[model samples]
Target: MRVKITKTNLWEVALALKILHFADLHLDTSFARIGFSSTVARFYREQLREALKRILKLAQDEKVDLITCGGDLYEHERYTSDTGKFLQGQFENIERIPVLLVPGNHDPYLPDSLYRRLFWPSNVKIVTNAELMPVWNLGEVTIWAFAHLSPTQREAPLNEFKLSDDEGNIHLLLMHASDMSSVPPGKPVHCPFKPEEIHRAGFQFALLGHYHQGRLSSLQASSVNVQESISAPGYGYPGTPEPLGFDESGHHGVIVLEIGDGKVKAELRPISQFAFVETELDISTATSRDDIKSQLQYWADEARGNYAFARAVLKGQLQPEIELDLTVLREAIGSYFRYFDLQNRTYPAYDFSELAEEKTVRGAFVREMLNRIKLATGEEKETLRSALTLGLQAFEKREILEQV
Candidate 1:
């Protein structure tokens, strides 16, 4: 059952309730493959442990009554007893704060899941029930939650369940769901639902997980549902406190919220230790790899992170005759970060107009390749063009063939 709050008593309930919301801890995730080094994996593990220590300290310092983890506390396939014990030990630090959590698709509630097999501290409460259930009633707040038992969960969380009455309690939901409206690229859609469903559910607040980027906002109940209910105060995805890759940019951290009587307040707290950055530079002006190295070095020095693991990409059309010594560029800039991936995605900057005017084999080659490019489709056309331009450039270097 869920309880809804009225506007008259919103502030009182908001003041009494204090929450430390974090999600997608993903402890023991395989960073080894991403970094291609054992030491990097160990480094990432230590970072996760440090983040836990910081969050616990924050909870105690701020006197938060509830510590809510939205989901994905660990990586299911790679989780181990030692790491699980380490997590349990982290929870033991919070003496009185009630830590509530739901398992996400990554760490689903399987039969042999860590949620079931391992023992947690008394203060910890993991919602691993297969069904959507109301597990706790704290004063004026009621929490409805459930765990993802498998990697692919298709149920629409709010649509499948029926709610009780307002009953003067603030209804808060904790679960992992993909916002069908703005699902992040490459993110799996588990427990998918439209935003309108959340608003019509009549919950005072909904704290969600799964997407690595945090987005918090208040949404009013839409008029689309004919059988409508009262509007919700807000919903949010706290995101992964730590970033998993270079693609996840911007500040990363947990959210702190206070709910009482009928009011709710939420704030994001940053806890990023290292910066995962990706910078794309136009290499059309550059003639060699040193230019690329300089551009990447400049970006690294400018980033605000304490430690930077950056991916430098060379973009834009390049001169056909320009040779890029990527190995040299990587070696020069690789020392600036813990990990680095240098990639070149440039096409030859050929002057087709100039080549067309030349009364030579190069001009003839260009015309032939252009003809094929019109008839050829996709990668084959691009490959033929590259081959023709680079080959002509090679022949031009022979000196005797430049005019012909």
Candidate 2:
């Protein structure tokens, strides 16, 4: 029972080796017990359950023979029997196809890990150690995997794997790692690895997990630390299958790779039970509280859904008399979606004529600050003025600067 998918000079098809690539599911079974009230925990539980169902349905629709789950299938180190039962039930639904897993940092391959105790489907293959473990060999293709289950947070043994065989069979390496220093600074370094080293390791394609934002890149490491031939052309991270937080947005999906004839074609397929969106609304002309609310409501209604999570930021000048009721707006927005944040940055319309005319020491200080503001960039001027205003208010109220 197999579908033939072949590329011909004139659109003819014969056979295609299709596999779905996805990672960082973060299916938190403990989410129900992690601080959220019983009701809220129930909500999280349902959401997680729905995501699993969605993935299985996706596999069925796509009719893939193999599903490559790079890693982080679960949230953490601990899982109750109930959670295990739920996972086993959901996985049973997906047992029709093979699922290849690479263990992530959170759910490492410790003796007590679920990967050790759980009786997954016979089609499931969990790579437990940092060694080349071959799972699938389809004539011209060979998939090799290495799982990083190191107990410590810092060391990554998988980074030592750098083997390249350009003329050999199609080699696929499955791993979960990061390039900490190479990425933008201030971000945490997790499962660090050198991109060029991976290319040197002689793999035709490296299926990676971790960093739940799906993206594809050539073998070239985007850094100066590692220098190697960049001709090897296979690298990517299939971000989380679903959005776990606000930062993960746009194109929440999975990658489908077709490997045959010593070549690979990748496509991204998006899936999510609930969508998350962030929007900015200019409030420069918003004259009153009612106006602001109306504008927000209009924008909210125009968004993807009434139940979608959103963050609306109001920027520009605002009248002093009007006070925006963020609480009321959030409630008004309804329960389908939660408004994570609403920030009002409308500056007050002001006349500095009186302050310029004053002769007191405080007035002189204000005058000096104003002179400096003239020479600053728009951003700098605004920041300085806001600071000065806050300081003045604190002085008048006889409050500490920190309190202000």
Candidate 3:
């Protein structure tokens, strides 16, 4: 797939140019706002939409030459006309900047896809075909992209590409694909490619989509011929532009790539309106609800990197006499953040070494439990340990009912 250009380099920047690349938005008006009342749902929907607006405006603010969306632009199954209009309207407002897009598994280009129905803005360019297509050439930059026509794609588009650096133009591949070597178990294996196949194909930057976590193939940046000072062999996933759930965490943002002047550099610009943060809080030393409240408040406030969706893990060994009323604690602190979940993983601080030496029934029970635990693996170990703790606590008149 080759695209021939007639226009002189569209961007007149001196060797350095910025391309804002992002993917896996999975925009759904129904999702991220489920189970709320109509009015409340609209409020939550607006929050997500507002984040998209900020991302679209970023291209103009950064003065980027091209805005590439790797894929999953919308939730295909749940897409509404309002969302289609909102997305296309935003593209219209992008002014004269170029917007390139491909469809991901969640938003594949089926016969009835929004890509086929809607009239996109003049600046928008999307590869709706299932094959490898290099349809755009802006003088110095060329883009080869394809869409996921179906959920199960066995074709390897990367294999069809053959690199020709003899022409000396910046070549980019925009598609939603899986790096088959390390794709996690059970993840939809769509448009898979082996790293060696990608390296052999020879595209400088492959802006891939689908996976929600950002990563670069090790081979993407390491292939160097001493003859060329700077190389474009590096490819990276920009991850989900805005984190959707607790599983999607850390710096949620877009990547700004500078691909000229004998070196290739990329910077992550975090522009999401919400960040998902899972905090592991050590509550072993927590003596009371007030203590837990103080720590929760501190982290809950900090988690609003914009607005936080937080899961606080209460862990470590708890003091024998102290009891944490989790329902009360959640009611008191849940309102501190946009989305909150509290997990009780704290264990009782038992003097096991001292108890192991005693000849009493409790000591015998502890020893028997310890012996069984040593032979167990996985969740079985944890279950047996909890059973022993609960059995002893019941014998000692320490049932957890009164605290709730």
Candidate 4:
């Protein structure tokens, strides 16, 4: 039987549900982009499993009423039978608490999907439909979820989705969707939807996934209004439980949602054991490779280098005769961090004013490149700068091994 809940009588009955929401776990990921060795990659994959274990432990300790995984629980292409068993075992440990999963693009609900091939715990509910389907009705709360039938699902799940007014339960949405308003660069759109569409569909809260940056959107009280309360219904992206790439650098974790006392409160609980750090080092004043190494060491120490997977970009005006060997630098100081990647963005410190006056081919090249750089913008300017550096190296008969 469906029970109706209204704001007028919200306080008359007890209404409390504690939920642990997480997404984008991406277990068994290749970690190829980070350029980690095979051994290191395996270690990171184990870390992801550890993260899931910690999340489950937290849920059991906190006694959450429910647990929702937004999606991308594992990479479908890399998932193995062992991983399937591990997942089943973990979920079974939290057998008392109901667990819901909405599959994302990386782990879609295909015929060969693990969701279909393997038997999950009775308490684990996997959404199998491409459209929004009502999966659970917990008296005062109703959860509607969906799954990505394909890896390239481009349909907007909430386009015309609307719940009937008669269903007075606190409607909630669980899915792997891209919030169109806050998509990062280079991220492909999958199951896109506007934030307003969620509330318009009468859903009190949306537990979302796909984005790797944790975010919570809720109403805020302002001084101008003075009377408005800050506890309006909203949606959130719990992001990835662990840092997947350098682009995902900020706090990555799960969202704890407590619904009671006529209000909903969301809090972020960080559970990532590793950090991805990206920073730039100015090598302008360095005279030798040792000097560059010293600067890198200093930057690493300052940034808490030992605990992070770091990418260092070396940028500055370097002496024309001094060529930086990125491979060598990485070999020298890579041990300082768990993982290290070095990029060279330095330009030759040429006296362009003096070179432009010379009658040599090198001088002519520098002047032309500088003029083009002045007229160019964005990536084009950087391209011209690189060309100039390479041209200078060719004229000097030096080995052009490093990227400028």
Best by TM-score: 4
Per-residue CA lDDT of candidate 3, range 1-404, in tens?
44343433323323566788888777774643323345644655676677678887887898888898888888888889988899888989986888888888888888888988899998998778777767677646667788888767768776666755344566677788987766755578888886666556655667778777665544544442111122446667767766766677555567777766534566666767666678888977787768888888888777754376567888888776666767777777778767666777877788877887889988888899889999999999988877876766776887563221
What clash count goes with each model? 13, 8, 2, 0
Q: Report every candidate's CA lDDT.
A: 0.75, 0.64, 0.72, 0.83
Task: Quote each prediction's TM-score.
Answer: 0.82, 0.72, 0.73, 0.86
lDDT of 1: 0.75
User: lDDT: which candidate is best?
Assistant: 4
Ranked by TM-score, the better of candidates 2 and 4 is 4
Candidate 4 — which residues are off by over 4 angstroms?
A: 1-12, 219-231, 351-401
Better of 1 and 3 by TM-score: 1
Q: Judged by lDDT against the true structure, how good is candidate 3?
A: 0.72
Q: Which stretches of candidate 2 lie over 4 Å from their true place?
A: 1-16, 29-45, 77-79, 132-138, 150-160, 164-167, 179-187, 219-232, 304-307, 335-340, 344-404
Models sorted by lDDT, best on top = 4, 1, 3, 2
Q: Candidate 2's residue-wise lDDT over 240-354, tens digit each?
A: 6666555676555577777654466666676665656777777768777678778877877677364465666777765544555667665665453542446556554544556
Clashing pairs in 4: none
RMSD values for the candidates in order, in angstroms, are 5.8, 8.1, 5.8, 4.3
Poorest 10 consecutive residues by lDDT, candidate 2: 1-10
lDDT (tens digit, per residue) of candidate 1 on 1-404: 35334433434554477888888888888875455467777787778878878888989999999998888888999988898888888888785889997988988889998989889899998897877777788777778898898988878887745454434567688888888877778877899877766656756677888888766766653422211112336677766777888767754677788865477667667776776878888988877656766777788777524377777778888765566767767788777787777777777777787887789987887887788888998889878866675677676673212110
Better of 1 and 4 by lDDT: 4
